[model samples]
Every structure is written in structure tokens, then in C-alpha cells.
Target chain A: MVKVTYVAHDGTRTELEGDPGDSVMSLAIANGLDGIVGECGGSMMCATCHCYVDDDWQAATGARMDGEEDMLESAVCEVTGRSRLSCQITLSEALDGLVVHLPEEQV
Target chain B: MSAGRVVIIGAGQGGLQAAMSLRQEGHSGPITLIGGEPGLPYQRPALSKAFLKTGEADKLALRPESFFATKDITLRTGEWVDAIDREAGVVRVGAEALPFDHLILATGTRNLRPAIPGIDRALDLRTLDDAAALRAALDRPRKVAVIGGGFIGLEFAAVAAGLGHEVSVAEAAPRLMARAVSPEMSRRFRELHEALGTALHLANGVTEVTETGLTLADGTEIAGDLVLLAAGVRPNTELAEAAGLEIANGIAVDAELRTRDPRIFALGDCAAFPEPGSGRRIRLESVQAATDHARAIARTIGTGTATPYAAVPWFWSDQSNLKLQIAGLADPTDDSVTLEDGAVLRFRDGRLTAVETINNAKIHMKARRLLAAAPVPTRDSLLQRNYDLTAA
Candidate 1:
């Protein structure tokens, strides 16, 4: 398990522990971290799980795949280099203490 | 009232999502999610596919039991809400009358049972329980006749055919999924199903249902070991209508999903609201619409997402080798332009309205993003870009 911080639109931080294989989206939802909606259940079909990975956790998460990069474009706010779908990122030691920003809209 | 205690009726996708979204949007008020179905609320999409194939009922749950405690949300499943007293804003489930400050109706939809003989012979695929029963029925050797060539019927036919069972689909429409897909897409799907060894009977509406078989409009009786009904759905508007709420095709709602009574709101397939990007009104049966609707209601009741909840609509269906993804809503009147990438962009007048893609996720996502922007791409420019809609 890994502890991660989810920062909402209003700048509130929710720190929670997530299982290794579970996604950032699933854990946020399982923990009720607020603002993270994994509507498609990690099918990568719906981009409701969109989130922003901070600079500190970007490299560990690696570059977005073609499928995710394309979906991220449709995400709520302007897609930055840091934007990523939380569903694609699973919890791992590499992401311990990782922090991601929830977009203003991800329903 | 102080938004005192928010009471949500119906624990399907929309109901569960209503409570979850409300809390997510920062509403700390007393939130309750009540579902008529037993056990945890699960997704209905898999009823005809994965669950029908493997019978893995456990995986389909929308959330774990601990989620309620963690989020401080209350879920009352297997309990039915008998009445909604709009003026007093109290819901009755049998003897208990639960009061509410704001009542949300996410009751969703149910299978439409057509008036046909021997209707009881056919099985359904709407709820988790229904899928479980169908899975057991598929165990024995049986020839299946599916009524209604919509997505659910076609999906089940494909799976049953793939399982070495002889399957036949009888649809009243001239083509498969006529109500949901374009003619081109429908034709393509027809060819795919036929190639999979499933017999297709277009425009063959079931006139009469017999114990051993179903008689079509053309007077042809197709014999089957078992019959399945996938005749589509009708909104569960009894609670709303009984409560004196304005009812159209569904419970009529404004831009905010609020019912005629401002204290109550509705969403999902049961709530027919004005279509964003277009003035037309429509109801959608998909996970995206339900969750999006839930979030919108939550924002209004929780934090303030005061902008008229104009989120773009999207949908998807999985059948055998094809995975159809649609972004936005379009009707038959919309002029459709097919892009070079096998993606079709639909438009009403000159405005882009929806995008249809098969097995092409990239184009689908791009189309959604493009439409999200104001002054969406037009048919001319979209064609110029070879339908590379991302050119925006």
C-alpha cells in the first residue's frame, strides 16, 4: 500500500492509503477523497478520473500513453504536460506520498 | 429548510452516484442512498456481456461495503420507496416516512414488457439478478430466440452464438440498433452478427410469443429452446408522477436537473432534461449520463457549479469484435459526415452535434474535446481536416 495526497479544486488535501494494484482513481473513490470520479471503472473509456500529477510525482508516473494522452485532451481544464487520468496510474512504492490535483470538472 | 437531510430514492447507478457525488462536492448534510435491488448497487452494462459469460456477480459492484462508512453515506438497498410527498418533502418506504430537505429522484428505468402471448417464457437482462438467472439458463444446450435487435439483444445474441449456441435476433426495426446507431453502423453490425453465425431477422417484430417459439410479423415461427426479451426500456416515473411532478417522456427537468418542485431533482434515464449545445430535449441510457448528472446535482446541492450543467453527452456498446463509442447526442435529422478515419461526426444545421467511432478511441476522445470547445467545428472544416476533428 502507498499513501498519496489528493488536492481538490478548493486546495483541500486528502491523504489516504491505496492498495498496490488499485488505481489512484479507485483509491480516491474508495476513500471518498472527493472530486475524483472514476465513472468507467478504469476502462480508460471515460475520462472522469482525470487528475493533475504534481512535478514531484510526474517522472515516477512516466509519460502518458497515446490512449490516455488523447482522453486527457477532453478533460475539464486546459490539459497541461502534468495532466493525466488517475485511473491509468496504479498505486506503487514509486508513487508513495505522490500528490495529484483534481480538475475543476471530472463528472 | 437548511438542506437538512438529503434523501435519494432508487439505488441504481443514478441513486448511488447521487449520494456519492453529493458528498464528493463537499455536501456534509445527511445523505442517504436507497436502492430497490438487493445487495450493493452494480453497473447494468455488464448484464449482457461479462456477467453473462463468466457469472462473476461479485466484481460488478459499484463500491465496497466500507465505502459508505468511510464517506459517511447511508445506503438502504433492497428497500423500495413507496411514495414521495412533494409538498411535505417526505419519502415513504412502506411504514417508514423519511423526511428530506432536498429529494433526488434517480429511480432509473426498467425493462419494457411488451403485450405479447407467452411473455413469461422469455428471460430479461437488466439487473444483476437477471443476469445471474440468464447465466444459469445458458448452461444447458439451448437454441435462443432474442426479441428486439437493440444493443442488449444483439449483445446477448453475439455472446450466446460465440458460446456455440444457435442464436437468432428478431428486431422490428429495418436494421439492428436503428434507434441508437447510424444506418451505416447498423449495416456493419448486421454483417458482423451474421458472420458470427447468429441469424438476423430485420423488421421481424414478434407478433405473438408461443411457449415453444415466437411468431414474427411475417407469420414465420422461429423455434427456440429458450427465449430472451431485450425490448428496450421505459423510465420509472411512477414515484414522480404519483407525487404530482410534471411528467413528459420522463420527469421533466430544467438545466439544473431540478424537477417542477425546486426541492426535488432527477437524473439518469428517468430524467429528461434539455440537451446541452442544442435546445432539444432527450434522455440517455448510459453510465456517463448518470454519473455526470449525479455530479451536476451534487454541485448544485454541495459546492456551486452554477453554470447550467451543459456537459457533453457520450455513450458506448461492446459487441463481439466491435466496440462502438459515441460522443454527444444526435437525432435522425442531424446531417452526418463520415471522416476518413472511420469516425462519423453528426451535425444539426451547421453545428457539430455528435461523433461516432468504432474501435477508434483516439478519434472519439478528440471529437469529445473538440465539441467541448465553444463554436464547435463545422461540417466543412471537419471534412477538410479529413475529419481529423482535433484540428481545432
Candidate 2:
């Protein structure tokens, strides 16, 4: 299981354990984490699970694909250079200590 | 008056969301979710995309089994609701009669099977069971003949071709996705599918489904091991229709998502609600519409706030490397303005009706917000800024 930390907009952090191959969006939904609506269930169709990857772990998260980048641009929250769709980021042992900040709102 | 008990039919995305939203909206009432499918409500969109690629059904579940138990939501699966007893205020599931203070019809839709010889031989991709069967068929190398060049068919063709299977798409219309996209966008998709090695048969329709292949209307035969019917879908409105509720393209609902009987409401693919700005009765099959409609209905049922449903409609389809995102609604006759980056802005009578983007979610989102503005952006306003929606 990969240990991932989801920080809410208000700076409230929730550490959760996610199995490898599961998306961070699924993990958030499974654990009942607020601020990650995941309306489209990781299809990248809905940008409801927008998250900002911590600057330190940005490189580890790697670059966003064109599809993912397009989704981020449509995200209800402000898209930053560090912004990423949690659905596109799969949980892996290599990124065990991943930290992502949830946006304020996801429409 | 708050609903004492809410009974939701179909138990799909919209039904499940209505149940969840009711609770979230502070409705401390008994919620019963009845589904025709055998298991929990799962994400239907992933069945064609990620689930086909990964074969992980568990990952597509919208909520875990424990969610219902914890939330005091009663989920009954594998049961088909047969009829709605309007006067009795109950729904009939075979011999059982389930009563409700308020009833929500989220019966969703089913694939439209054309009246062709041996049409039963063709498979569908609407349900999880259908996807599972399709996936099992894809386990071995097989030739796939898709009946429709719409989103589902194209998405399935992409996956089949990606998996090294021979695929052919037969679309009756001159262009692909003709109902939802512009000519330019359709041409681009045709190119994408052709480049992916999927044979395109546009302006031609299947006349018959043979055991080994399908015969076109013009007597052209396409050889294939498996046939898929992705032509389109029809709303499941038998219950509402039988009960004497208004039925047009779907179950007709008013601005508040209420049927002729205020106690009965409908949403999702089954309900034809008026388009927010245009007032045109439209039935959407997207997850965004389902969730948004559920939320609006739940708010009205739970908090007694009869706010008319007005959320922006957006949709996306993932076919191979291309991701098509559409914001707002567009008719086939709507004029389109193509941008330099390949995004198409649809306009009707000078007002923006929709925006279609290929792998451009930023512009799609911008268009959705812009269209939802108090006074929608017009053709002049958009052209003045060169279609830069953010320049408001």
C-alpha cells in the first residue's frame, strides 16, 4: 500500500493508505475524503478531483499527459503548474509518500 | 414538507446520487435504492474505457458496499421495478409493492436495437454485464464489427484496435457523432479512427447481423467474429408511461424535475427536462447531467427549496489518444466557428450554444462557465475577443 497525504484547502491533512494500481481519486472517494468529488469516477471526463501536487513531489508525480493537462485546464479550481488530476495519478510504491492538496471546490 | 421516505428507481449513477444527496441535504429519511442490475451501482463510463483496458471492475464502483449500510440507505439489487401505482403511491417489483413518500424515477436508458434480421446476435456495451461479455470476447483475437460510429462504438473500436484486433465501424450518418459534434470535428475523428486502422463505413447501415458478420443495407458484407450494437439508446420509461405520466422523448419533468404528479420526480437519462437557457426539452445521458439533476432534485425534496435545475451540461469521451470534451448543448443546425487550436464554438441566433474541444478541456470548461453567465456570451462578443472566453 502506498501512503498518500491529501491536504484540504484549509490546510487539514488526511493521510490514507492506498493500494497500488488504485487512483488517488478512488482512494479519496473510498476513504470518504471531502473536496475530491470524483463525479466521473476517474474517467478524466470530469475534472472534479483536481489536486495540487506538493512542489517537492512534483518531479516524482512526473509530467501530465496531454489529456490530463486539458482536463486540468477545465478544472473548477485554479490550475497551477503543480496542478494535477488525482484520477490520473495512480498509487505506486515509488510514490508512496505522495502529498497532494485538494482544491477549495470541485463543481 | 420533507420526504419521510424516498424510493429511487434504476439505482444507476443518478439514482444512487439522489439517495446520497438526499442524506447530504439533511433529509433524515428512509432511502431505498432499487436496481435492475445485480450488483452495486458502478461507473458506466469506465466500462468502455479504463475497465476494458484494465479489467478491474472493483475500481469502477462509485461507492463501497459499506457506504449504504453506514448511510442507512437500503440498496436492493437484481430486482426490476415493473410499474408505478400513482394513486397508491407505490412501485411494483413483481409481487412486491414498495411505497414511498416521494418517488424518483432514474430508470436510465437501454440500447436501441434496430429491427434488423438476427439483430439479437449483436452485443451491447451499456451495462457492466454487457461490458464483461464484450471483454471476455476480446480476450481472444477476433474481428469486431461495430454497428454505430457514435461515442460508445468509437470508444470500443479504439480499445479493440489498440488490443490488436481488427475493427470496423458502420455509421448510418454521413459523418461520425453527427448528433453531438460538428462536421469538422467528425472529420477529425474519422481521420483518428482511420489512422488507428479501424475501417470506417459511413453513410451505410447494417441490414442484417449474420452469425459470422453483418450485411450492409447496400448488400455489402463486413466479415467479423463479433458484432456490437452502439447505435443509440432509448429511455426506459415504461413504468412512467404505464402510470399515465407525461412521456415525450423521455419521462417529461417540469423545471423542478417534478412529473405531472408532484410527488413523483424523474431525472437522468430517463427524464426530459427543459434546457436551462433555451427551454428546449432535452434528455442528457452524461454523468454530469445525472449528478447535477440528482443534486437539484435532492435539494428540493430534502430542503423544500424548489430551485429550478440549471447546471451547465458537459460531456467527454476517451477514444484512443483523443479525448473529446463538450460543454453546453448544440443542435445539428447550429453554426460553428472553428478556432485556430481546433476548438469549435457552436452558436444559434448569435448566442453561443455549445463548445466542442478535442483534447482541450480548458476551453470546454471556460465555455461552460461562459454559457452559464446571466447573459450568455454572443457571437459578436466572442468574435470580438477572437473567441478568447477568458477575456470577458
Candidate 3:
């Protein structure tokens, strides 16, 4: 199991565990975390599951996918350099303690 | 304002979201969500796409069973609402009459069964159970005949073809998905489906569902062992009509999605509200519309603010490695210009109406943002910008 911590915009932290193959967005959604919406069901079509990777965990989380930046244009929040769609980030054993921060709102 | 009992009919995506949104807006009122289908609320989009291929029923649930208990919501499944008592503010469900301070009608839609002979022989793909039965039928190698070349039929054809089934699609229209997508998109998808080895029969209507397969209106017969009815759906408005609520194409509602009776509201696929800019009555059957409408209605009930439903409409369909996305709505006469990047911009009366893209998420997203602005980008504006959505 990989451990991932989701920090809300107001600095609330939620740590959860998930299998290696599961995506971070799916984990947050299954746990009922209000941050990520994943409206398109991890199809990378809807950017509602946008998140900011913690600076410390940025290297471990790697880079965005091919169409990730394009989908982020539809996000309701500001798109920063640290921005990443959580649905594209697949969980793996290499980076277990992945800490990510959620945006103010996802609609 | 008193936190009175809020009763929502229909447990589909919109109905479930209404209950959840009311709680999110801090409405402490008692909430009851009634659904005609059994089990928890599940999404219908994947029923024709991934669910048919993976048969993963567990992943379709919108929320867990514990969600109702934790959120203090009364979820009554496998139940049908008999009638609405607007005078007494109660709904008849079997022998019981559930009262409500405010009533929401989210009664979605049902499949349209044409008067063709032996139509009952063809199966439907509306609910989860229908998808399950269709999946079970695909367990063996068989010739699959799909009626209607719309989103559902084409999506199912792509999957069945991938599964090594002999797939053939019959569409009554001249092109595929004529009502939803632009002509350019229809042509592109026709090529895509053909490349996937699926046979396409355009401008042909099924006159009869014969024992062997389907007989076209031209008297040509297509042989198949399994038949699917993906024609279309009709809004379920009988209950609202009998209750004396105004009914147009659907239940007539205002910008706030409320019926003539102040205490009654209708939404989702069953409500025909005015369009944001055009003020034309229209009804959409997409997840984006349903969920957005639910949020708008919940805010009106929760915070006492009747904000108009103004979310930009968007839709998507997956077929054989192609992801088609549309950012806005378009009429039948809308002119389409295909950009160099293969994105189609729909224009009506010089203003941009919709954007259709295949696997081009950036352009689609940018089009959505541009369409929602105060002054939409005009056709000449896009042409001057070299059809660049980011700048427009």
C-alpha cells in the first residue's frame, strides 16, 4: 500500500492508503475527500481533479501526462507550475508518502 | 426560513447530487431521495463504454451505502412514486404518503420504443441492469446489430467490435450523431468506426426486428444474433402532467427550474428550462447538465438564492481510441468551420455556438471558457485570431 497525504486549501491534511495501481484522484474520491471531483471518472477528460504537488514530493510525483496541461485550461482555479491533474498521477510503491495540496475549488 | 423536509424524486445523478448539494450548503433539513431503480445510485455514461468491456459493476456506484447513513439521508431504492399530491404536499408511494415541505421532480428519461414490429426483441441499454444483461449476452461470439448511430449505439459498436463481435450499426439519419455533433465530427467518427471494422448503414431505418435480425425500410435484411436498441430516450413526465404541472417538451420550468407551484421544482432530463442567452426552452440529458442543474437547484433551496442555471453545456463520447468532446450547444443550421488542427467551430448568426474536438482537450476547454464570457467570440474574431481559442 502507498500512503498519500491530501492537504486542503485551508491547510487541512488527510492521509490515506491505496494500492499501487490506483490513481491518487480515485483514492481521494473513494475516501470521500471533498477536494477532488474527478467528474469524468479518471478519463482525463474533465479537469475537476486538479491538484498542486507539494514541493518536497514534486520529484517523486514526476511530470504531467501528454494532454494534462490542455485539460487544466478547463479547471475553475488558477493553473500554476505546480498544478497537476490528480487523475493522471498513478500511485506506485516508489513514492509512498506522496503529499499533495488541493485547490480552493473544483467545479 | 425553516429547515423543512426536502423530498427529491429520482435517484439518478441529478437527484443524488441534489441531496448531496443541499447537505453541502449546510441545509439541516431532513432529506429523502427516492429512486425507481434498485441499489445505490450509479452513473450511466460508462454503461455503454467501459462497463460493457470490463463488467466492473462495483466501480459504477456514485457513493457507498454508508454515505446515506453518514450524511443523514433517507435513500429509498427499488421504489416507484405513484403520484404527486400538490394540494396536501405529499407523494404517494405504495400504501404510504410521504410529505414534503419542498418537492423536487428529478424523474429522468426512458428509452423510446418505436412502433416497428417485433421491437420487443431488441434489448435496451438504459440502466445498469440493462447493461448487465447486454454484457451477459456478449459473453459468446455472436453477430451484434445496433440500431441508431448516436453516442450510445456507436460507443457500444466500438466496444463490441473490439471484442471480436461482428458489429453493424444502422442509423436512420444521413450521418452519425447528427443531433449532437457537427457534420465534420460525424464524418470523422464514421471513418473511425469503419477503421475499427464495424459496418455502418446510414439513412436506413429499421422497419421490423425480425427473428433473424432487422429488416431495413428499403426491404434489405441484416442478419444478427444479438440486437441492441440505442435509438433514443423520452423524458418521463407522466407523473408531473397528472399532477397538473405545466408540461412542454418536458416539465416547463423557469430560469430557477421551478414549476408554476412555488413549492415544486423539476430538473435534469425531465425539465425544460430557458436557455442562458437564447432564452429558448431546451432539455439536455448529459451528466454535466444534470449535476450542474442539481447544484443550482440546491442553492435556491439551501441559501434562498434563485440563481439562474447558466453553466456552459459540455458532452463527450469515447469510441475506438477517439475522444470526441463538445463544449457548447449548437442548432441544426449552425455553420461549422474545421480548423487546421481538426477542431470544428460552430457559428450561428456570426457568434460562436459550439466547439467540437477529437482528442484535443486544450481547444475544447478553452472554447468552454470563451463561450461563457459576456461577449462570445464571433466568427470573424476567430478568423482574425487564426482560429486560436487561447487568444479568442
Top lDDT prediction, candidate number = 3
> Which ten contiguous residues of candidate 3 chain B have the minimum total lDDT?
B58-67
Q: Candidate 1 docking: what grade?
A: acceptable
State the lDDT of candidate 2 residue by residue for A72-105, as single tens digits. 7667778999999898998889899999999998
Q: Residue A78 error for model 2, in Å?
A: 7.0
Recovered share of real interface contacts in candidate 1: 0.41
Give lDDT tens digits, candidate 3, residues B107-184: 999999999999999999999999999999999998999999999999999999999999999989999999998888
Q: Write the per-residue lDDT of candidate 1 for residues A5-104, one digit (tens) a residue.
A: 9888899988999778778887876655557767776666877888889989888999886578777766767788888989899888888899999888
Best-performing candidate as measured by DockQ:
3
Instruction: Mark the regions of model 1 whose C-alpha exceeds 4 Å error after superposition.
Output: A1-36, A50-66, A75-107, B1-3, B304-307
Relative to the real complex, the DockQ score for model 3 comes to 0.55
lDDT of 3 by residue, A1-107 (tens): 99999999999999999999778898887777877877778777788899999899888888889889999877889999999999889999976999999999898
* Local lDDT at B317 for model 1: 82
Candidate 2 residue lDDT tens string, B1-392: 46488999989999999998898788998899999898888889988897888888877778888889888899999998888898898888899998888999999999999999999999999988899999999999999999999999999999999999999999899999999998989998999999999999999999999987989878889988999999999999999999999999999999999999999999999999998877889999899889999999999999887979998888899999888989988999899888888899899999998899987767877787888898988899888997887686
| DockQ scores for all predicted structures | 0.36, 0.48, 0.55
Ranking by lDDT: 3, 2, 1
